[model samples]
Target: MKICVFGNSHTACLIEAWRAVRLGGEMDFFVQAGTGPAGMQLADGRIEPESARHRAFLERLGLPVRLDLTHYDALAVVGCGISKFRLTDVLNCCHVLGWPCPNPSDLPVITEPCLRAALSDALAGTTGASLVRRLRAARADVPVFAIPQPAPSERLLKMRCTGGGFRRLIRQGLALHAAEVFRQVARAVCSAEGAVFLPQPDATMTHGILTTGSFSTAATRLVDLKTPHPDQDILHANGAYGAVVLEALQAALRQGGKPCIPR
Candidate 1:
């Protein structure tokens, strides 16, 4: 299968996973990395790689900006508007534990509707959804899949991105519960936009929110290859996580056959 994935840094881990599964021959992947929504756009009725760096990366991958999508078997749109750490202090401080619990010992709760509303508000103008819309407009018949960026690993509390206050509450298993709510909301967002949303594989998750230790290390792609261990990379998942995603994608493709996108 020839698959083209358009994403940000998270694409690195996915590629690593592809290699880990030894799907090199069975699946050929072309990937383009972009900063955010700035990477892709629809111009003059044609899909184009917007960022110069992204375009160059595609070229390095032997996929040019004007490359034909029809030649590929499937398109996997990853990590565009998706936030790798949804509950990070900067993003969801207001709704971190589903409610503002000043104390970690205080259990916070959120209703489904409330959680969905929050997610919708957070992901209102996601680049992934817009990209999918443009792709579907150009090729409605093509199978397109949108996978959100992986959730933060359990080491999230140690990462500088996480606030000390939120970190304490997350350990109480609030992060896992919040992740389930976020996943549901994310699916609803994808469904509303006519894109097939694939959640992170269950096996890669240890406590639902936290990533498993085997796949917990951040992708070396983000750092110099010489760095033996990442001192602060609680975001990206290792190849093991990617393997699970690939397996899940294959299963999903098989389940839907050729008609994968929900209209």
Candidate 2:
């Protein structure tokens, strides 16, 4: 089977997890941008077309210029940001980490409609709408699956309280919040079309570990802190989480549906 995952770093994590569980070369994988360490690169070394850091990191990963998805059997769309959906208001106010409010005061002033408009504009001419269209066109034949983003790590949440003490705090928070929003959007999109929405595993244990300060050991054991994208601590999937997602996908497939991929 071949799978094409379009999104950001979270998508990459899912691909990695899928690879770990795949045996005997039965499956092929492809990934696109969403958020985090993995993604496509531009001429200047950016992962996407926008950011310098992302470009540099893309160069570091050595990703290919284009991925041919014609032979894939599944397409797993990972979570994006709240802003990505234009729901900045909900995020600015209720987000546990003070999202959409890089400066806490910005929260009180940003209006919901304005946020919506901003998101709409940001998504304009992007691959998102095209992806939706492609899914609609292919739904009758291909099995399209949506994977919800996992909950944020406790350390990440705590880091938020530091008032951006960490250099990339705001960026990380935005990415996490976006992933949450993307999960909701993906589910809605799938449900409307009778496609499968794989339920994300309950992240209480991961959260609990963060709240109780067990992250040090967990990070050392489960994460590669020495990697270039060290900021991805929150995005990386451990062996356990990866296993859960894989099992869920397998279950979904067992119901007699083919994997979601392009023709």
Candidate 3:
């Protein structure tokens, strides 16, 4: 089956893994790194580069100038400002009733309904969500998948910013509860747009949040494959992790499984 994927720098790992596995004709990719959501939309059922940089990057990666979803059996939107980790940022400020708040007594509590509504609202505006909606609109027959950027590496436990959520949630017990809710919300949102939300592989994470060092070490930038992600870089995964993701995606396609969080 042919698959077309669009993502940002985190996609570099997938590219490297694809090269390693030699999926010569089965895969195609477009990498556009950054937060701006200016240029990615369908025109006459085709998606082309939004900028010269995007075009150059696609050229260097050897992808077609125009992406027509009809040609591929599956399409995926990965990373590029999409992730379950976004929940942590929310947790840091305010948390839902069952969430593990750092200062539970001090921080105000929100109902699960409130959290879900907020997530739905946020998902509606995301570029990833927009792309998925358009991809499905352009080709209803093709299956679409939305994979969030992986959680931070457990090695990041060294830093307060990255590890604080994991530490706090794990300490409070029922850590997986919030994660499961996030998975459900993501799935519901993506499903609404005719895409399936694929959670990160269970083996890649620790304590339901931080990724293991094995999957995260030696990550490279999509812009420059030579430059390694800095030691403190916790978001990106390596080629091995990419391989696992590819495998998981394939299996998910085959099984057509529900988006349930792995315990």
Q: Quote each prediction's TM-score.
A: 0.78, 0.52, 0.89
Query: Number of clashing residue pairs in every model?
Result: 0, 20, 0
Deviating ranges (above 4 Å) for candidate 3: 23-25, 36-38, 98-105, 256-263
* Candidate 2: 10-residue stretch with minimal lDDT: 208-217
Q: What would the per-residue lDDT of candidate 3 be over residues 165-228, giving only the tens digit for each residue?
A: 6677767774587778678888888888878888888988887766889999999877666578
Best of the two (1, 3) by TM-score:
3
lDDT of 2: 0.44
- Give the local distance difference test score of model 3: 0.75
**lDDT by residue for model 1 over 1-263, one digit each (tens)?**
66666666666676666655676435544344444434566654445666677667666655446646666666677777665354443224343333444543433455556556766766646777776666666565657778887776767655664545346446555666667766777777766666677888877876556676678774546322223246476667777777788778788777772534544
lDDT of all predictions, in order shown? 0.62, 0.44, 0.75
Model 1 is weakest, by summed lDDT over 10 consecutive residues, at: 220-229
Which pairs in model 1 have colliding backbones? none
List where candidate 1 sits over 4 angstroms from the true fold: 20-34, 41-47, 61-65, 87-92, 95-112, 158-169, 222-229, 257-263
Please list the residue runs of candidate 2 whose C-alpha ends up more than 4 Å from where it truly belongs after superposition: 23-25, 33-70, 82-91, 94-130, 138-140, 160-186, 193-195, 203-235, 258-263
Which sequence of candidate numbers ranks them by lDDT, best first? 3, 1, 2
